[model samples]
Target: MQIVKYLKQYRIPFSGLAAGKHNFEFEIDDKFFDCYEHSLIKKGQLKADVEMQKQENMLIVNFHITGVIQLTCDVCLSEFESPLDFHERALVKFTDEDWNQDTEEVLVLSKTDYELDIAGLLYEYANVRVPYYSKCAEQGMNQSCDPEMLAKLSSEAADAEEDNTEEQIDPRWDILKNIKNN
Candidate 1:
């Protein structure tokens, strides 16, 4: 895919790594998110630190993610930057036969494979950590939302609630209500 070119740097060649820990660092910017056609992250600046521990049979990779991303607030429709920090670990093993993994944190690759493509894992891990309802940072602290939009939305919601409070009885349900009263 065309996106592969942008993520090529995230590949780690594990065949030559010594049986020890190796560290790699990456800076994720706006261009990184451009690789994905549909993504909630419109703009971002993030730092990724990967620690790879290689053993004779298995590999352990730990990712530390920290940064800020610009997101559209669901409540106010305003864009704001939110801080991010998360840690993810993956266990990878060499396999002789092709198989699908049922585990979320484990991966199996062919013995002949030279490098591991970590871009997909990093992308998933990062996205899953984002809050579903993004709101302005100030709103979370009880400061304020977008004044004009908030006021309009508040008025509409109040009207809807008031309308719902005056309930109309269906003819079928009215008979049941009379029976209950009797």
Candidate 2:
């Protein structure tokens, strides 16, 4: 995967680490988002702190993300920076040929596997923190949305709602409705 090359630093080779809790830190930049073609975040700066707990049979990874990400406003298509802060945890268990991840937070890996590549996990955490609808603040110090675009979008939405309220029927469908009425 293209991500593997850029995020090679995120790979945690636990087979050699002594049984204990270990901490690793990394700084994520815009280049990290380039790995995914359809990523919502094309540019960002973030910090990640990963805490790995090694046990006899399983590994527990705790992730903390904090920083800012560049996003395009859905309302005006203007770029803005949004703060990102979240925590996520994952459980990795070792097994042989029985990789079952029906549990959302748990991952199954081969018993012989020596490392865990956490690039995907970090990406997911960052993506999850993004709001479904990102818009520049209507009233804020950093409000930078285009007024014309916002007005256009509002007018379009109002027009759409008006159209929905007054449903149009095709002539063929009208005949069917009349037959049912009779």
TM-score of every model versus the real structure: 0.80, 0.76
Best by TM-score: 1
Q: Over all chains combined, what TM-score does candidate 1 have?
A: 0.80
Residue 25, candidate 1: alpha-carbon lDDT: 90
Cα lDDT, model 1, residue 63: 95
For residues 77-112, could you state the per-residue lDDT of candidate 1 as single tens digits?
A: 877777888899999998888778738989988889
Candidate 2 structure quality by residue, lDDT tens digits, 41-146 = 7888999999999998899999989898988887699888888878899999888866655376998888899999888888878887778888778422377788
lDDT of each: 0.82, 0.84
Evaluated against the true structure, the overall lDDT of model 1 is 0.82
Residue pairs in clash, model 1: none
Which regions in candidate 1 have their CA more than 4 angstroms from the true location?
138-143, 156-182
